[model samples]
Target chain A: MAQPDMTRIEAAGGRPEAIRLETLRFAWPGRTSFRLEVPEFRVGRGEKVFLLGESGTGKSTLLSLICGINAPDRGSVMVDGTALADLSAPARDRFRAERIGVIFQMFNLLPYASPLENILLPLSFAPDRRRRVTDPRAEALRLTGALGLQDDLVTGARAAELSIGQQQRVAAARALIGAPALIVADEPTSALDTARQGAFLDLLMTQAEAQGATLLMVSHDARLSGRFDRVLDLSEIAMTTRGAG
Target chain B: MLLPALAWQSLLSRRITVGLTIFAISLSVALFLGVEKVRTGAKASFADTISDTDLIVGARSGGVQLLLYSVFRVGNATNNLTWESYQDIAARPEVEWIVPISLGDSHRGFRVMGTSAEFFDRYKYRGGRGLEMAEGARFDDLFDAVVGADVAAELGYRTDQQIVVAHGLASFTEHDDKPFRVSGVLARTGTPVDRTVFVSLEAIEAIHVDWKNGARIPGQQVGADAVRQMELTPGAVTAAMIGTTSRLQIFGLQRWINDYPEEPLLAILPGVTLQELWDLIGVAETALVGVSAMVVATALLGMAAMIFSGLAERRREMAILRAVGARPWTILALLSLEALLMAALGVLLGMALLYGGLFAFRGWIDDSFGIYLRITAPSLRELWVMGLVLVAALVVSLAPAWRAYRMSLSDGMTVRV
Candidate 1:
């Protein structure tokens, strides 16, 4: 396979469309039976999209493709109008660190790190993201404050010490830090009660909107779709996707 | 830099395993480096046991055996040289000085050496370092005696104290009527010299006048003062240390003595003989090093096992790091860095233990074993071994680090846990 040319796909300062997929096809190797094909997909910059998917619907695979962690077998993933397939693996990693922030279901924060340290992790990897912030620690503090976590909670306490709800907010704060171009949340609110789930979604949506970030959240719950700008079920996007090939 | 911080924090979370691993590595390192120290020390101490003598002339035997008895005070000589042969060699113009030593007597397990006054003035050990008295002067009277540092210390004898010379090699049979006064005590030399009691050749002759063939003649009790006036010069000597006027004549003199017609003799160069003996013992030293190397390998393997076992529990942790934008290689580097830190710290800990041990036991080792070991810096070879240990630790860690890399790539940000 021909490798991507990272230097040619470098984008400058201005913002572009958040996500664009063209005839995307992907599958895990060794078990070639299962596959996913997205003929055409686009999410506008600053769009809040809810991707509804059941457990086996391949939502995580699609997210991995979008973030360039898994390269498409026969298509292109374009974020900010830059083709992820056109960048090398290392470049793709740098691009993801600079542009995409992801929140997993639970335990998203590093168990050994304090809440603030967890939130500041992305900046340590992406110098460009760090350059955009005047003071990273202050930015982390602001994000945690906006996420409704107290100062004392984020300062000295490790992520493992936080309660389930507190850890969810800390994950949100981490994903929302450095004002990345996109935020991908994979069942981030599943561990929360219904009332806290609504509150957590509200905080996440508000933080993403404030940074002008494109929020692509995947969840099985349909009740939270009313608050998103757009909603699409994973079954509509992934075709014949099996369990990790 | 940030990777190290993360690695350190990660290790701190599981400090117990890491601590145990480091401790195990340190003990192995200490054993490895400690054996090296003792090896070098043994060679150096052995080499320094005798110096500046052109030849050690003794009964015909192996060079090592000759050196063992003449220099180390170990074992007995096969035969003694007649007094006339010693005088014949001493009269040569090439012979600058000679110290004839006769051994067979003992005082409380310390060997007794009978020698002339020339011994104090000309004999040398450890590169021409002459004997220095720690207490009184050299023996002047017929019944006066000089003690080595260990002899004086072990027997608690000071100048002016009287001590009996045993009739034989062991200290059980004493010559009570012929007790001698301790006139001097030699300073510690960290050699066999420190375990011998020295007296004039006249004293050796006088104490044995009534004895024949290892037994006391029943009717021949000679008074101490009368025997002192009689001819007390020794008839034969065990060995003679010859210092020639020119280094060029040493081989000729050695050849001449070895072929002497009256008796069979062996003359050996101390340096050459010492080297031969060290080569014989070098095999054992190499084995010690090989065993310690295996111990170090085992300790590093323990560290690798610990890292491998942690991978299962850390799968989710790996996923979290990836979510925070750590590359797969970063995960690899983090794991390897932890192992490197442990090995480096182990080397430091091992060195500390080695030097600390040397310092603590310096006196006891010198006094008991007569092996003087100084706390010196690590030699280039020792440093290379330490470096090899770290490299081995890193190599051992590679398997686990590669596993982490694979886990991060396969599991992505959604570890099943």
Candidate 2:
């Protein structure tokens, strides 16, 4: 089922917003005191935005809410053009699997899987994503190679056997393999040294830009903020994004 | 399908503990199935002891007592029927044939039965199979003896070996002076007949001619040669097994024997009496099954403990799966699939143990005890029990599956670990 490139470009001709959140209010189910309230947020297509928030400042929570991992108490999270809150839980999982690529902090790779297997795991859960690739293993190999992880290392080594920086690159290759519409990096460079973090960020940003996917990088480090198009501090959002930072 | 493969890989990574859990399950399964096999086997062997004999007639007593003494050689007979009564029963117009069995003496704990040549010609067991000699000719002399297969094996007796017949049941009271030569060794029938020693009725009469009131006369010692000069007619017999001329006449003949007037007599149908005996002993059999079932439960609990302890470590793995778009139910399915694989492997290993154990110990069991357990395929009841065991293990394993489901929901792509 090959759709013409004309139709894909037409479908991509949406309101030009990759992610839009309006009046988002979220509180963990059991804890009513801590909540995240965002009045307005938008990330343009292909734009790289640095979200600056320290640990516990709802940085991970915001990423989870945006990706449909956790639902907001009262808000609308529109990814691409669909509202995630309107879909069923299972449908939301499928939506996330199909449209969003998440790269977690270090040690997030499946420990028992090889680098290539880790990269292909999202496709295992989401067949639509798998259908997007002509050959998933080859795509994984290309991503790993472009991310500066050696071909031999990615092919032969398991996640546990790889160094922390290598695992981080493998995680990024995994996120970029299926070329989802949005790439969310949740403090993914926290474990890498300052020298390697910059290189890793360069590779990640280059891959996201090449795929025409919007990038949302969350971190407390302000030094890396200058490399992005815009920066949003969590503290200035509202009283809702409280206690975490 | 990919989730199951992933589950397999996770289990393989923890191969040592998983292997041990499988081993525990297999042992319990083996013991559980083993007990059932022996229970059914023993029942079959017991029911098959004297199949063709329509009615077993003995001195008046409880039907179980008569069965135990006459067929199984278990307890002493309460009384003996006079030889005249046996003759009258054998000569009846409705009788097809009769095998008069005299059980009292023993040869090294093996029951010594004084039966006639008709025993070889007419007696049948294990579905109408007659005795076939394994080594030598049948007993034809005055004192020639036919030893059973088990007796020959355990005592190492062969043709022409002189075996002394003990007067009483105990081995200490030996009839040392008058010994009988083994004429033949009977083939194994895997029945109580395999443990009996057979001789002519005349031989039994000659051996105890001088004994009165269960003790020997101090001055009476008859030589083997002199026994030929004396008349050798058995005064009484333990019991008589009768086959009616027509199958329809069996009930009538049983009623006649039960009402005999010369001496009090009890007559029983072999199949019915065997079932009664089984019912009497089935209580212990049930306890055996219950104990083994507990053993299986303990093994499953051990598996649950192993899975529960590993859950804390696997929370991170669950979060990773959820992050990659695996639903909570997918995590649940993965855990359940792991348990099913372990149960299937355990059942296969238990079947192997059952058949292997039966094959290895068939002979020793037959020789030491007369219970013959065959290496046949599992019965439907046995298969059902195995199915129940699998279901139970799966049910026990769901605890971890539920925990994983809840953890995946709460963790939400952010593993605390």
Candidate 3:
């Protein structure tokens, strides 16, 4: 239902400045009490900024809103200096597909699919990114290699066969493979052992640095806070955008 | 990813659910295909009535009824055509051929017919060719007989086997003295002849010489040989097959026979009579469609419950999807695709099972019920129904899919931990 004249993804392409978010307040209209009011959040150009909050403080909600999943009820969330709330649902999806890569704690990989297939699943929906890549499979392998996954693990290893740490690394490679400007990770280290968690974090940060994409890693683990350039606990930033809890 | 691929994996992972669903859908497909098969069978039997000859002449009855009793051996004719009338009718200038058939007799639970060599050479049921001799040739001497394909198979009769005829149509022998040699066996034609035993008309007259009112006379005996030598004079024939000079004269021929003054007669075109008979068969078709539709609908209902029941567990999965930049719409598509895929697999599985069952039991069904369900590849109608099942499954999935979308978006990145 769209004319070719309206395609915007071609103009922005991939760059560190592509995705941006400002003071944003999101409300769930029907469920009277459930609402997320994030007043300020932004991941600067190629900045691997870690955001922290406890389990129930809407840390995941804040990341999703910043990533343009749920449009803010008030204020604004901009990616590449364009207000995300203003775009249509399909446009938002296309935008996310092209310029924003999201990673979840569980990795969100389809169980029966091999790691390579899981890595390529996101590209299926993002036609623009698919076209942009000279060869997406090669790009996926490169990302997987940079994330310290062995070449053998990329082939026949299914998501269920991989350990939690390995799955997290797969999730990271999938996110960074498309060369999207921003990658959002949600409690990705929580499922791993303390030893694997540090190694996993190191691999993820290294991959983000290599891709030169902004990273907004959400976690409640305060011990890991010192590694990032700036660790902003979500609550401290929310006061200005949403006056109270 | 293509929907089927995802669906296939989902189904493979959930073996029990998918198996149950497939079982449910296959039964529905069988019911649907079964109705179509029986309808085709009835039409085949009806068409066998007048395929070769141009016309059928018999005592006045519904054109279809006359065709059924005379050609297909379905029903009995209330009025009999006198032998004199048959002689005059067969003598008509336009009548190129005639095979007078005298019914009203039975042999070991099969219909008994009495006729001459012309009955074997000229009388055609499905096409112009006469019945072939699967074993021995047609009867040459009187009292020599050829049994139908089914009768021979059922009775285990081979060439040179001798069988006795019982008076009337009873299953047991009443006056079984007259024995006839089985000279030939006919091919299976899926018609009444499959259950008939053929003998010369003289044999029929000879066998009954001692019988009166379907019983033996007080003190009379007529040997099979002596009975055949007597002057042949057939009193009545149940029906007669007539061949016209041209197809264009069919209407005129029908009118002429129906208006005959000596004996009331009815003539019917085989194709048209078959179409009318379908009205009677249509009832079963309607019932089958209804039952199969309910089955499919109920299976979809089961699919819906399977999904909605797992909604609580899937909340986390949907949240994960949302985290991976899957829009609410994507979540809906994913869940709905799950249901659509299951229903589709069920339908396909159902069809395959139906084909298998038919392939396995076709012989038994044909033997027992006189019907054959072909395991032939599904036709366009079956495909259309399968397609409908997919669409229905998709629509059926919409409810839980919408709910999943809302649940995911509301919970967002933070599901209730």
Q: Estimated TM-score per prediction?
A: 0.90, 0.91, 0.85
Model 1: residues >4 Å from true position, as ranges? A1-17, A22-25, A30-40, A240-245, B107-109, B121-123, B126-137, B149-177, B181-187, B216-221, B245-252, B259-263
Positional deviation of residue B190's Cα in model 2 after best superposition, in angstroms: 4.0
Model 2: lDDT of residue A166: 94
Clashing pairs in 3: A18-A80, A20-A78, A20-A79, A23-A39, A39-A241, B26-B350
Worst 10 residues of 1 chain A by lDDT: A1-10
| Residue B330 displacement (Å), model 2 | 1.3
How many clashes does the backbone of model 1 have? 0
DockQ, per model, reads 0.57, 0.63, 0.38
Model 1 Cα shift for residue B49 (angstroms): 1.8
* Cα lDDT of model 3 by residue, A1-245, tens digit: 12222233344344324445455666655654556766555566788788888876777667677666677777877765566767787777667767778788884676767788778777776776677678878888888887888988887777878987788888888887767778888888898889888888888888788777888888999888767988988778764233343
Q: Which stretches of candidate 3 lie over 4 Å from their true place?
A: A1-23, A32-43, A124-135, A239-245, B1-31, B72-75, B127-129, B156-162, B171-178, B210-229, B299-317, B335-378
Which whole-number lDDT from 0 to 100 does residue B391 have in model 1?
A: 95
Q: Which 10 consecutive residues of model 1 chain B have the lowest summed lDDT?
A: B408-417
| DockQ of predicted model 3 | 0.38
Q: How much of the true A–B contact set does each candidate keep? A: 0.45, 0.57, 0.38
lDDT of 2 at B260: 89
